[model samples]
Target: MNFEYMKNFMDSLTEWIIPGNSVVIYKDGKKVFEYSSGYSDLEKKIKKTGEEQLYIYSCSKVATVTAALQLYEQGKFLLSDPLYEYLPEFKKMYVKDGDRIKAAENPITIRDLFTMTAGLSYATNTPAFEKARKLTDGKMDTRTVIKCLAEEPLLFEPGARWNYSLCHDVLAVLAEVVSGMRFSEYMKKNIFEPLDMNNSYYHTPNDVIISPQYIYEIQDTKNIVELQQKEHTTGVVKRAYGNELVFGENYDSGGAGIITTVDDYAKFAAALANSGTGLNNNRILSSATVKLMKTNQLNEAQRKTMNWRRLRGYGYGLGVRTLIDKAESGSNSSIGEIGWGGAAGATIIADTEEKVALFYAHHMLNPQEEYYQPRLRNVLYSCL
Candidate 1:
């Protein structure tokens, strides 16, 4: 394995991605690679340690979905179960055709949300979604947001297409209602503590000051300008008020929110890669459930509908995306590799067939500059 390329890739990341941080890679249940560079607090000139937690963004979706699957395994819910059963507000949802809000002939199911085919989009260019945003207005709080979503019409019929929307937010609330506990509490009890992911949480306390997020913005001609050295004030940040924001507020958003460190998250990913075995030989999930979760649930046309890079022939599983074609992925990813990333640039990739897992976390949201997902994946696979 030519690790020189990986080292180069990690070094180059400082120029393109997070200024300084740490990365950890595991193979066959061992830490095969680790690197730390730059500083966690650039202003204070504090070098980044191996233990600082990073905002694991949408990567939290995997944890929330895993909790949902646990409930499913306990016969609390089913894939085919109409989602509206647990969240009745989702019932009577309709679609916007021209000027009218026509009722959807079918109800959106839990499977629809998992498969990204529920016709429920998030911050996308759909008439209904646009209207939904306006309806919710500044009240993006947990209860008001979902109420707005329930009132809005679906963009397409259930199972008609795939779009990355706020489906996970809805999932978070669903987990709460069905499990009879708040979403955060449910995760802490079932997923976090069980897996010893003690460093993971949704919010950062005021006293726990770290360097606020910073990024480069392209200015005139070729000059790149430094954006505001401020914390990201979207989604969870806005709701980080009241009731000690160290834990997430009421915005039970399953898609994003989990905060974790390189070590704790690596253990979680290793468990998924190791057929659900965690610390002390405790199995967080059965091998059967994990296998089922990795299976592709999209068909040919559905696969064609997904337009994102690295997702050409991918399908959504219970939580992770399932790869159906390596050639289409245009990377060295295995046929059965499953994983996803967070909005803040945190990423986790697991190749169950190959028994490998990769975890990287940084805080950059420029989706255009091309992060190290495929590059690192190819490098890791080439090592094998």
Candidate 2:
């Protein structure tokens, strides 16, 4: 497969919007291509190598679901089991009606968490979150915070629609409860240790050298020229930590809390791409379960809620986007291309059918996924 076109496309991204970026591609459990472009620190003129550790933000969801699915493989829980069976705090859930909150007509099920149909909300400023903070003295422990989250009402009835919320975070705490380990611990023993992903973690390692991330301050989207200017795009990312989503040292943010290098995450991606088998020939999941993970879990009405620009012609699968329509997505890739992205320009694409996987990332907060994600998929497939 020729990667010249992929290189050119990545180069253009550096020239225009992306400050710096890197990508890793694996075919049949082998690293076939890896490249980097642009500057990690634009003001310092530091070239961005593909090895820089990055905060993968929401890409953590992919790992969260994988970790939880490990427990599923052990017959720990069923998809249709009521969520309250594991987390007693959710025994009674409330839903936000038009003008007032009311008791939820349906109970949330384990499947709802996997499919983003649990009606949970991503809003962190809710009274429940604040209560969690005060109760834990800002430690925001996964179980504590999630239990407090149950105090808030859901956005809709469970299984009614898809909403990108704290569903994965809820799922993470469930994994912790089932395994009798902290969310981070469970991930380490099951997902990271088995896959040999030593660099991936819930907390940023003190020794790993990471580039100072940046944010593209959009002066005004109406004025497109400003978006291309250096002053508008390059600034030290103001966050105090590697990931703002990680509320405290004890908090394992299942939604937006993974710090790892491109290759580190690519190992996980490649495992899924190769039908849950890693490069070392260790199987993390059965091929049958991997197929279920990528299968579209959204129905027609539920799909209507997954109307993000980048997710056109796709259906929400088990914590990932499963491609169902190539024409609608304008993609050349196969129909079941499954993966997810992060807030700061991390994209995961795994095609189990083709035994290929890709992890592409730029350490910028506002990486334009709408423009780059679909095109990157199309371009990579073109090269193949």
Q: Which candidate's TM-score is highest?
A: 2
What is the total number of backbone clashes in candidate 2? 0
Put down candidate 2 lDDT per residue, 202-276, tens digits, no spaces. Answer: 786777766677776663563435455545345435344467788888989888888888989999999999888
TM-scores for all candidates: the values are 0.84, 0.96
Q: What is the lDDT of residue 302 in candidate 1?
A: 69
Off by over 4 Å in 1: 1-3, 124-144, 219-248, 367-371
**lDDT, candidates in the order shown:** 0.69, 0.87
List where candidate 2 sits over 4 angstroms from the true fold: 222-241
The CA root-mean-square deviation of candidate 2, after full C-alpha superposition on the true structure, stands at 1.8
